[model samples]
Structures are given as structure tokens and as C-alpha cells.
Target: MTDHNTAEWWRQAAVYQIYPRSFADANGDGIGDIPGIVSRADYLAELGIDAVWLSPFYPSALADGGYDVADYRDVDPRLGTLEDFDRMVAALHARGIRVVVDIVPNHTSDQHAWFQEALAAGRGSAARDRYIFREGTGPDGSLPPSDWVSTFGGAAWERVADGQWYFHHFAVEQPDLNWSNPEVREDFLTTLRFWSDRGVDGFRIDVAHMLTKDFPDPLPSRAELDAMPQDGAHPLLDRDDVHEVYAEWRAVFNSYDPPRTAVAEAWVRTPERRAKYASAESLGQAFNFDLLEADFDAEAFRHIIADNLAQAAATGSSTTWVLSNHDVTRHATRYGLPPLNGRAEKQGAAWVRAGGPEDQLDRETGLRRARAATMLLLGLPGSTYLYQGEELGLHEVADIAADERQDPAFFRGGEYDGLGRDGCRVPLPWSASGESFGFGAGRSHLPQPAWFADAAVEVQAADPSSTLSLYRRALGLRRRLQTDEGLEWVDTGRSDVLRFRRPNGWEVITNFGTSEHEIGEEANRIVLGELRDGRLPGENTVWLALRA
Candidate 1:
């Protein structure tokens, strides 16, 4: 069992992210609920994760996939009651797992009571002061307030009948809250206390760097903003004012008995700015997305790891490693496809839509590389966040019909114009045969392709060579091997090979070249991968313990 009293347990923990809507469905209602999560408590414990970061389950319209929260203190009736949420917390805690719920402070749903009041109270009222509302530009206020564009696409300003426009960084249904308002700031504190009181161990702040904005009288166009130096404070994102908000939040977290923690989903451009969010005075940790955006090349991975470690060291915070999440294509599928061109930011969603070209898509190679990457990630020296279904080596389901699509980004004309994140958000397959592949008794909200049956948990659980089995063994061993908090790079003499040794004599070597590499040193035993004739094959990783 884990010692909850241990200082900074998260620094060396393995956290699994659960998209609540797709994890499991206990009521056979085609949607996963809190009750469903309760049912999978044992499964999560068996996965050997120290904590689970649950995506938002608050009342929402699901505009932008629940980032648009309608209520901060209640559960969505469709999902379950507050009692059910309490039960889920208890179930996970009973199994020695911590709970981290998502907190969306950047924006709120249009359906929220505050937004509704803002609309009815009209322009210049105290209600309207809670959110950013401004007079539109152009004749008779017919245009948007400024040239700012939504990250999801389209204009960032949405007009109401009162001739005023409200700002939104995402979809029209989500209005950006004015953090400068005392009421707005105080309400979020209330929200933090409410969840902390419910026994939630931590929070994952969505768009953590975007809570504050400094819009100039004449906002710059998207092109102008893109060309400007991102290292400095910006008009809409990563401004200096944002850190003060988290500083207040940190105080609330410290009030708890164990001192609740938080991780920020900040996408700041530079490493220096990113470290500020993860500083001891702010959120405890911030996600390092450099690894997620890297190519499957040894040199690229080396640089990313080195940079992230340096940033973590500077801030006195733990580094975070993540390969896949709900917002992007699964790494297994990405490794199978060719390198992307101008649309690289989309992560090959368009390539998947083009049928994954039979000649170019190498499934076997992709899975092999994915396994190697997992070994490298687990062997690292800090927190690791694993997306659900990745343990089963699940790839993206690119063939969902258009009519069945959700994801608000799909309708927006940006990187997600032709395809959105639904492909990665499909329900997990538990059984080899069922209408929803044992996800539930009824049909899933999204369609599960026929190929899911082959990768179902039931099929992989019994196969020793299967990805699921590998994860089980790797996680079990990770607990014992993660004794050191730092690693030294070993000189493999090959640019395509990577070797890093932990202080405890455990080493990890990965070959990204086209040919096999010799194992030049003696080891006590191979803990993860096998060696063919004392050599490691390309696109493979092996864990070893050096002899004393």
C-alpha cells in the first residue's frame, strides 16, 4: 500500500487519465457514468496506477467535450448524483488510488446561471461584469469586438441581442470569465473548497494559463500575434496576471489535511514560462507536451527529455511525461503513418481519414515502437500520465460516420475541420464480442469499429505477449525500480540509440535505427524486453539491471 503521508508522492507516480464518458457504462444507457467508474475500481487498482485524473463530470452541454462547465458544485444528472461521485472517491481510495478531478476555470457554459443572468441583466450591469463583454466594432456594432480568433476556430467574440459581444477562447457556447472580478475569483475558490471537501485529492486545471487576458484597445490579428515573441506576456494567454490566480488556489490546496495538489494544462511556448506554472508557489506540476508533439526519433526524444528535466529542476517541481490524451490521435496509430506535412499540428487525423494507406501504414511496426516508447516512459524519473485504452495498444478509430460525430472542433474550420478528437474518444472494448464490445449492455454513444474486438481487454489479458500483459508486468516492476529521482545519459555512440541509467543501477536502452545493436555490457537480468543473440532489435527497448 502507498503511504499517503509521503512527501511529494506525485513526483514519482504513474497517473492514468480517465475520460469519464467513455470509461464504462453501468446503467446500459450508452453513456459512462460515475457509477460505472465505481464498478471499475478493481480494474484500476490492478493497473497499478497511483492515481486517476478524471475528466470533467460536472453538469455541462459537452460543448468542447465538457470543458464548458455549467455548474461547479453538482454532478450532471445524466452521469450520476453527488452520492455516486462520493462512492467513486471511496472505491478508488479503498484500493490505494488517489482521485484528481478536472477544474475548468478559463470558461463556463452559456447555460450556466451566471451567463444566463449576464444575458438578462443586459449591458454594463454587475451580472455582465462577471464575464468579458464589450461593444462590437464596425457600424452599428455589426462586427466582432476585435480580430481575436477562437482556438477552436471562428471569431472569439459572440454577439447577443443587446448589441454587446462576449469573449470566448473556444466555442460560442463557452464564454470567458473575467478573472479580475472579485465575484468570479471568489466563486472559483468556493468551487475548489467544495471539491476538496468531497475528498478529491487534486485537480487538473484545464487551459490553466488562459484564465487572465489583457486585450488591447486594438487587438492584433491572428497573423500578427503569431509573429510576435511568445516569451513575453500576451494579450489573451500566459499573461503575468494568471500566476496570481494560481497562487490563491495554492493557498486553498494547502488548507487540506494532506495538502491537495494540482497539475496545469498550460501550453506556454517557452520552457521558462512553463516552469512558472509548475513552481512550488503555483500549481504543483504542469504537463510537458514536448514529448507528445515529438517525432518517433531518438535524437528528438533525447532533446525533449533533457529540456523538460532542466525545466523541472529549475522550478523544484516534478516533470510530467505524456504520449497520448483525449485531444490527439493515439501514438500507436501515429507511429504507423508517415510524417505529417503542414498540417502536422492535427496529428495525422486527415491521414486516418484517407484510409491510412495500406502500403504506408505499418501496424506491426507501430505497435512495436509504441511498446518501446512505453518502456522508455516508464523508465523515466518522474510522473507519467497514461491515457485510457493505451494499455491495450488501441489505435485511433478513423471511420466513424459523420452523422454520429460530436467534438465541437469537428464543426469548426481549423486544424479539426475535417476530423476531430472523437476517433480517440471511442469507448473501450472489454469483451471480444458484444454490441458495444462489453462497454455496456446498450450501444455506445460513438461507434466501435470491428477491429476493436481483436484488441479487447479479454483477448489481450490472457496473451503473455499482448500489450495489456506487458503493461501489467511493466507497472508491477516499475514500483520496485523507481527508487532514484534522476538519470544519466549513457553514450551509446550511435545517434539512433538512446541509453539512460538511473542512480539505482537500472538502465533503459532503445534502438530507433534500422538495424540491431549489440548489448556491450553485462547485466544481472533483463526485466522487460528480450535480447536476440545478445542484441536488441530496431524499434525496441529493453530494461536491464547492471551487475554489482
Candidate 2:
């Protein structure tokens, strides 16, 4: 059993991110719930992950796929109640898997009591003060208060019957709260305690960088906002003010018996800016998305690895690495595309929109690179997060019908115009063939493709060389290599290859070239995954344990 006193167990942990609605469904409800997660505790334990990070399951309008939380203290009925949540946590704990839940503190659903009251209380009321409400500019107050645009699309401000405009970073239904208000800060603290008291291990903070807004005199236009220098202060997003909020949250976490922890989903521009969210006084870790955004190039990866490790060390924080999440396309599909060629920033929500021809996507090639990437990621010396079904080599469901697409981005910018995140959130496949591929007893909330049968857990489990087995083997072996030490580069004089030596004499090497690379006779290596013909094939990674 993991000792709660360790307090730093998250430093080198492997966390599985379970998008509740897509993970598993125990009942015939078509939606994954707490009971389903409870039943899968054994599967997770066998997968050898250290913890499970559950995406938002709180009461929500699902305007942003549960990011529009209605109640921070209660569970959504579709997912389950607080009782089911407690039971799920207990079941996971019995199997030695920690539970880390998603916390969306930046906004609340329009259906939330606070938001509802704010809408009825009219402008200048105390209820309205809890949220970012302003009078629209212009003659008739018809125009929005600012030119700021939503992260999903369209205008960020929405007008109410009271002639006031409210700010929402994502959807009109998700109103951003005023963090500057003492009541808002205190209420979040109460919410944090509610989960901590319930024995939750940690939290993955959503919109962690966008919590603080500077309210620029004339809010920047969409283009200007996107082009603003992340190094300097901005009107909204990653402002210095956000750190103050995390610092206080850290204090609350420290007050707990073992001191709960947090990882921020802060997508800042530079490694330096990302480090600020993971400093000793703030959240314990901030996901370094630079690695996820890296192109399939050795030089690009090497630079990101070195920069991220350096930044984490400087801040006394653990480096968090993740390849894919609910919001982005799976790396398998991503790697299948042409290399970004230093245009990694283009890999945003609209990646699929700018994608090449369907024939250009080499799924087989992408799967090979994904296996190699997993080895490289697992071999690193820090925390790693794996999205659900990624172990089964699940690619993004590209053909999600317009009617089935649920992401707010897809609707905010007109149907099909904005390729939403629904593709990545397809229900996972557990069986080779079933009504919903064993995702649930009924129709899945999001339809699974017929191709999912090939990647089903049942099919992959029987195949020793499948990606599921690769993840299981890698994770089972990772426990022995856990450490806070950073990685060191092993120069092989090849620009297309990346070789890094861990402190334990374990070397991780990946060849990005189109040719096979020789494994020196002097080196004794364990074939990690997807190695071709006993040699390190192009886009393959292997781990070497140098013998004395």
C-alpha cells in the first residue's frame, strides 16, 4: 500500500486519465458513471498505473463536455451521486490506485445556482459581483463589453435580459467567475476541502492559466489575443495573478494529512512561463505541453526534453508529460500526419480542419511511432499521464457525424466548420464485438466506429505484441525506475536520433530516421516496444541496460 506520508508520490507516478463519460458504463444508461469506474478498478490495478485522474463528473449542462460545472460539491446524476463517488474512491484505494479528480474553478454552468441567481439579481447586485459582469459598450449596450473571443469560437461575452454582458472563456453557458472576489475565493476553498476531506488524492486544475484576467482597457481582438507575447503580461490567460490563486490552494492542500497535490492544465507559450504554475509555492506540477506539441523530429524532442527538465528543476517541481487528452486528437492520428516542420503551434483545436487527405494518414506508421513515443515517455524520470484507451492504440474517431458531435466548439463556429473534440472522446472499446463494444449495456453517448473492434481490450489482451501489452509491461517495470532525477542526453552524433541516459544506467534511444540503427555490441538492451527485426527501426525506441 502507498504510504500517505510520502506526500511526494506524484513526482514520478504514472496516472491514467479517465474521461468519465467515455471510460466505462456499468448500467444501461449509455453514459459512464462512478459505478463503472468502481468495477474497472481491477483493470486499472492490472495496468500498473499509480493513480487515476477522473475528468469532471460534477453537475453540469455539459456545454463544454462537463467543463461547465453546475455544482462543484456534488456529482452529476448521469455519472452518479456523492455516494457512488465515495464507493469508487474506496474501491480504487483498496487496489492501491490514488484518485485525482478534475477541478474546473474558472467557470460555472449557466444552470448553476450562483449563475442563475446572478442572472436574476440584475447588474450591480452582490450575486452578479461573483461573476465577471459588465455593461456592454456603445449607444444601446448591444455590442459586447469587449472584443475578446471564446477559446472555442465566437464572442466571449454574452448579453442577458438585464442589459449586462457576462464573460465566458469557452461557451456562453459557462460564465467565468470573478476570482478577485473574496466570496469566490472562499467558496473554491470550501469546494477543495469537500474533495480533500473525501480522501481524493489530488486535482487536475482546468483552465488553470485563464483564471485571472487583467481587463485590458479595450480587450484585445481574437487575432491580437492569439498573437500577444506570452512572455509579457496579457489581458486574460496566464497572467501573474493566477499564481496567487494557486499559492492559496497549495496552502489548503498542505493542511491535509498527507497534503494533497495538483497539476495545472496551463498552456503557456514558453517553458519558463509554464514553470511558474508548478513552483514550490504554487501547484505541485504543471503539464508541459511542449512535449505533446513537438513534431516527429529528434531535434525538436531533444530541445523540449532538455528545456522542460531544466525548467522543472529550477522550480523544484516534477515534470508532467502527456501525449493526448480529451481536448486534443490522439497522438496516433497526430503522428500519422506530415511533420509540423517547426510549425507545432498549428496543432490546436482546428488540427483536423487543416488535415491533409485521408489517404495521407498512415495509421500503421502512426501506431509504430506511438509505441516508440510511449517507450520514450515512460523511460523519462517524472510524472506521466495516459489518456484512457490510448493503451489500446485508439485513434481519434474522425467520422463523428454532425448530429452526434457534442463539443461546444463544433456548434459555436457552425457545424463541421470547427472540428470539435468529440472525436477524441469516443467511448472506449472493451470487447471485440458488442452493441457498444462493451462500453456500456446500451447505446454509447458517442458512437464508436466499426474499426474499434480491432483495438478492443479483449482482442489486444490476447495479442502479446499489442499496444495494451506494451503499456502494461512498461508501467509494470516503471516502478523500479522511479526517481526525482532528471535525464541526461547521450550524443550519438546522429541528428535524426535521440539517446538519453537515465541515472540508473538505463539508456533510452529512438531513431527518427528512415533507416535502421545498429545496437552496438557493447550495449545490452531490452527491446521495449515495436522494435523491428531485433534492430532499432526508424521511429522505434528501445531501452538499454548497459552491463558491466
Candidate 3:
């Protein structure tokens, strides 16, 4: 066991995301519940993850995959009872791991009480101020509002059957709250307190940077939504104004005893300014858009890491990053494939899918890729996060046919990328039997990937070379970082490599590019994982503890 160091909790923390519905099934209800997660808390404890960030478990209409929240304080019957959530939290906390929940504040399910009251009372009612509404003609002459499109595929402003316009930034059913309103702001703050009071440690704020849109005014104009969000792209969010809203939220977080965190999805247009939203003014952390760039070359990653450090040094505020989230395809699908059977990887060789026989392994162990990506992911100076199955070296294939796909992003924006999210938000692998894999005795919400049986937790737990073991060691090493100690990024900036130094003389070097690179020798003891004579093969990664 590592020494206790709560000050640097985030630095050494390894967060695991659980998409509540697909983790496991304690009861035979066809849907995963809080009891399922509680059942798996021991599994998480054994895996050595420091926290489990459960996706929203609040009541919802199921539109937009539960993002449309209908009730803020109650647990969805589909998931389980409030009693179940309490038990899950207790179990996780008892194991020394924190629990973070996804908080959707930008909007609420139209079925929520506030919206229901607004609809019943119509315009000029007290509840109408809770949401944003503008006066104008709908896209077609027959509707009641202006031309903003719903994230679900139609106009952002929807006409109540009563000939009144209601606002919905994402889906028509998810009418946005007016953060510009002090009353709405207080209500959301109270909601955060509601959960934090119950024991949730932090929140991965959903559509975070989105809570405040063109307040008093309507959402982005039709022309703005159609344009690409690049360096000079239109400012859909992260305006100089809304930083106050974030400050308000952070202040509330500060009120908690343990100081629970809040991370935002601030996909601002320019890289330089996007880095600024998290200057610790309004939020503890905001998503770094650099990782989402199409050209994820070695030079690109090197530049991104350097730029992130520059921002931290200049602002005195930390930075955060995530390689893959539920919104995008897995790293294996987007960047590179893992190696087959744990063999040393070679360059100029095309990688294939990771599945065949129990022993055949995916053409690649994906370990090298997983190790490479995670090494860089953790080595970065500030807080780091990972999606649910990432620890199991889980790689999902794009098999959801056109008909099976059900992403609100697809229906809302044709200009948006193909339905890429569902593939990423897949079921987690837990067992090895051909029929069960432990998620259940038989069927699941989605088909288990071909490699799941081999990669299943049951199987990996027994193999020392398994990806799960690597993460356990890696995360356990992270837990050793002392909060009072400072972290410095060593500029060994080679195109083929990414390296950084953490507190306690720990360093990790990842080979981001195809070519092999020579990493400088470790000054301290080469403890934990290792690098031989400062050399890392293509896609190979090494982490070491130094004595300096």
C-alpha cells in the first residue's frame, strides 16, 4: 500500500468511468443498475483505480441516451433505487476510491418539473424565466420560434402546442436552463449540493462549457452552426462573459469539505484561448481540444504537451486531458492498433483487428498502444481521465449498422461526423464464457466484442501480463505522488517521443510516432516499469521512478 497523500489526490488518481447501464446486472432486469456497480466495486478496488465516474443515474426520458434529465434528486427506476446509489457510494468510499458523477446543467429533460410548470403556464409565467425563449417565426411559417436547429436534428426553438416558443440547445425535449438567470443558477447550485451532500466527490460536467449560451439572445445563428470549429471558428461558447458562471460553480465546489472537482467540455474555437477557460477562474478543468485534432502525429502530440505546459506556467492554473471519451472512437480505432500476442511491434507494418482465438490475440496486444497512450495521458502535469473499458485494453469495433445507430448527434446534425458515439459508449467486458462474459448469463444490450472473452476481467485478473495489471501498477505508482511536491516537465522533445517528470522522481516516456527513439537514462532508480538504456521501440512506453 502507498503512503497517504490526499493533497495531490488528482495527480495520483486513476479515474474509471462507468456508463451505469452497461457495467453489469445484479438483477435480471435487462438494464444495469446501481446494485450492479456496487457488486463491481470490489472489482474496481482490485483493479487499483482511484475513482469511478458514473455517467448520469438521474431520471430521464432516455432520449439522447439519458442526457435529458427529468428529475435531479431521484434515481431512475430503470437504473435502480436511491438506496442503491447510496450503497454504491458507501462501498466505493470504503475502498479508498472517490465517486464522481456526470452533472448535466445546461439543460434538463422537458419532462422536468420546472419545464412542465413553464409549459403549463405558457409565456409571461414565473417559470418561463427559468429557460431561454426568444420571440420570432419558426423556420417554417407554421412554427413559433426562430431558425436555430436542435442538437437532435431540428430547430433549437420548439413551438409548444400552445403557439409559444421554448428553447432547447441540444434536443427539442431538453429545454435549456437560463444560467443567465440568478434563480436558475441558484437552483443548479443547490442541485450540485444535493449530490455532494450525499457523498459524490466530483463531477465530469456534461456539455459543460455549454451551460451558458447567448443569454438574453438566442443560440448560435444557423450560419454559425454550419461552420467548422477551428482556430478562428465562430465563438459558440467560452465567451469572456460566461466565465462568471463557471466561477460561481467552482465556488460552490469549494464549499465542500474535500473540495470535489468539476471538469468541463469546453471545446472552444482557438487552441490558445481554449486553454484559458480552465485558468481555474470558473472551472477546475476544461477538456483540451488538441487531442481531437485529426492529424494526431507525434509532432502534434509533442506540441500539444508543450503548449499545455506553457499555459500552466503562464496562468499558474493546471491543465487536464483525455485521449478517448464516450463521444469519440477508441484510440485503437482512431490512431493505431495494438500488437498481436504481446510481440515487439515493428514499423511500416499495418495493424489489424485484435481478435481470433483465445491465444491468437488481436493482431496486436493493443497493450503497446494502450501503454503508449496512457503513459502520455498520465505523465502530463495535471489531472487525467479515462473512459470505462480503457483499462481492460478494450477496443470497440464500428459494427453498429445504420439502422442500429441511435445517437441524437446523428439525427440533429448531418454536418456532424457519422454516428461515432454509440461505438465508444459500449458495454464493458467482465467475464469469459461465450454466452455470459459475466455481464449476464445470456444476452446484453449490445453484442460483446470478439476479444472480450480473452480481455475479460476474469481472464486478465489471472494473467500478470494483462493490461489490467499494467494499469494497477501504473495507478498505484501515481498514488505515491505527494501533493506538496511539485511536478516539472522535462523538455526532451524528440519527434518520436513524449516525456515528463512527476513528483518523487517518476518519469514516463511514450513513443508517439512510428520510429523508435532513444530516451535519456533515468537518474533515479529504474523502478516500477522500465526503459532499457533510454530506448523505446515504436509504440512502446516505459515508466520509471528516479532517485534524484
lDDT of each: 0.87, 0.84, 0.68
lDDT by residue (1-548, candidate 1, tens digit) is 23334747888889999998898999999998899899889888888888999999999998877788999999988899999999999999899899999999988999999999999999889999999999988979999877878877888899998899999988999999999999999999999999999999999999898898777777787788777765547777788788899999999999988889899999898888898899989998999987666668998999999989988999999899998998877888778877664556554455543225446777888888888999899999889999999999998787887899888877785545556789889999999999999999989999999999999988998899999998888888888778757889999989999999989888899998879999955534678888888889999999997544
Off by over 4 Å in 3: 1-8, 138-144, 215-221, 224-236, 294-296, 337-367, 411-415, 434-436, 481-494, 513-525, 528-535
| The best candidate in terms of lDDT | 1
- What would the per-residue lDDT of candidate 2 be over residues 402-500, giving only the tens digit for each residue? 898898777776322446778889999999788999989888999899999999999999999899999998888677654446578888778998988
TM-score for candidate 3, please give it.
0.85
Give the per-residue lDDT digits (tens) of candidate 3, residues 389-432.
77777765466666765667655552244453666666777878
Candidates 1 and 3: which is better by lDDT? Answer: 1
TM-score of every prediction relative to native = 0.96, 0.95, 0.85
Candidate 1 vs 2: which has more TM-score: 1
* Candidate 3 accuracy as lDDT: 0.68
Model 2 scores a TM of 0.95
How far is 407's C-alpha from truth in model 3 (Å)?
Answer: 2.2
**Best-first order by TM-score:** 1, 2, 3
| Model 1 poorest 10 in a row by lDDT | 349-358
Cα misplacement distance, residue 470 of candidate 1 (Å)? 0.8
Error of 2 at 280 (Å): 1.0
